[model samples]
Target: MITKKQIDNNTLSDEEIVKRIVNGESYLYEHLMRKFNLRLFRISMSIINDEMEADDVMQTAYINAYMQLSNFQHKSSFSTWLTRILINESLLHKKRKLKQTQLLAAQTDNEYSNDNPLRRLMNKELKVILEKAVSTLPEKYRLVFVMREIEEMSVNETMEILNLGESNVKVRLNRAKEMLRSELSIYYKTNEVFEFNLIRCDRVVNFVMNKINKES
Candidate 1:
């Protein structure tokens, strides 16, 4: 049995490790799990809002990924492929749970406590105001916003993942940004400068490349 300790010290690129697993070296897969578990958990959390369900979704995602590894084409990065699997697993879990709830999966606050600094302000009312501002967004706009802003998926990647046209993606993104700006303008009540940053594809690619190097 592969232990968490061993997973932490694993040494193999995703391609090499996946090949090993496909060749019946299943133990090597523990490294892949370790490498991606946190991210999968976060994505699951975003979709489901429950930690336990997110945990289950993460487990199921890895199982599915392993089963489908043979079909993984190297056209896109392995992380992107794995992320698609994770998102699918998460949405499936969400859909199943929504059968018992009145809420939509995309509208829930599935993020951790530290996700936004505005939430940690001393004024509870201000926090609620911020939540209400975000919560009032239409599901479509919110989904695109969270995927783009929080997950940092590229426009092209998000369009591919959601099977949306470029124009539709742009429209949704523009509407989301406009809504946020409108809300923040009201919240700030002045021309206060806000420092917001976005994660670009190059940074993400470089980070994943470094991880691959360290693993191998």
Candidate 2:
């Protein structure tokens, strides 16, 4: 019974959207997905470091959030709730990937190589260099760096999403910035990192909606 007007209303906050979805207007969940899709994808990519795997993790996280919509308690913003879910899924995926790589005896390379077409392209742009620099950070620092710097999330939001104290969030963010400073002296735009393809966004929306429809 959701209407186009309801979905299109700019004044509708995320909490209101969640309420509508949980109240059985499930078709409106697409609005929530579209709202957080890019941010969640960046979070996934920050952990997984592979485009395809990140996309899978993003989709899985969205599915998990959708299935658990009824249990949402409104303790935090919907974005924070969704982000924690994404972090958990990404960590699990990373663990499984590590085990698989170990089983297959895959060689790990420490040096960045020009063999990767993407890496080659990154070499050509200052903006990509900034992204590559951020990606090179250790996992712990990188997460804080992306949430704080790249995504421009507030410290309070990042701390809540990561379950860290204020001091811990500040320390990690500072360390991440210091690490990047040694490599690049100038600021560059951040929107280019892990750029979400529009076609892929539509695909995820359609896939999730279709799955939800079938289940209902």
RMSD of each: 19.6, 20.1
Query: How well is each residue in 17-123 modelled by candidate 2, as lDDT tens digits?
Result: 88888898888888788778899988899999999999999999999999998899999998999999999999999999899888666433323443455565656
Summarize candidate 1's per-residue lDDT along 45-137 as a digit string, tens digits: 988889988998888888888889999888887789999999998888787777756454433443433575555563577668767877878
TM-score of each: 0.43, 0.47
Error of 2 at 76 (Å): 0.7
Q: Identify the runs in model 2 with alpha carbons over 4 angstroms from their true place.
A: 1-3, 106-216
Candidate 2's error at 10, in angstroms? 1.7
Give me the overall lDDT of model 2: 0.86
Q: Residue 124: error of model 1 in Å?
A: 38
**Runs off by more than 4 Å, candidate 1:** 1-11, 102-216
lDDT top scorer: 2
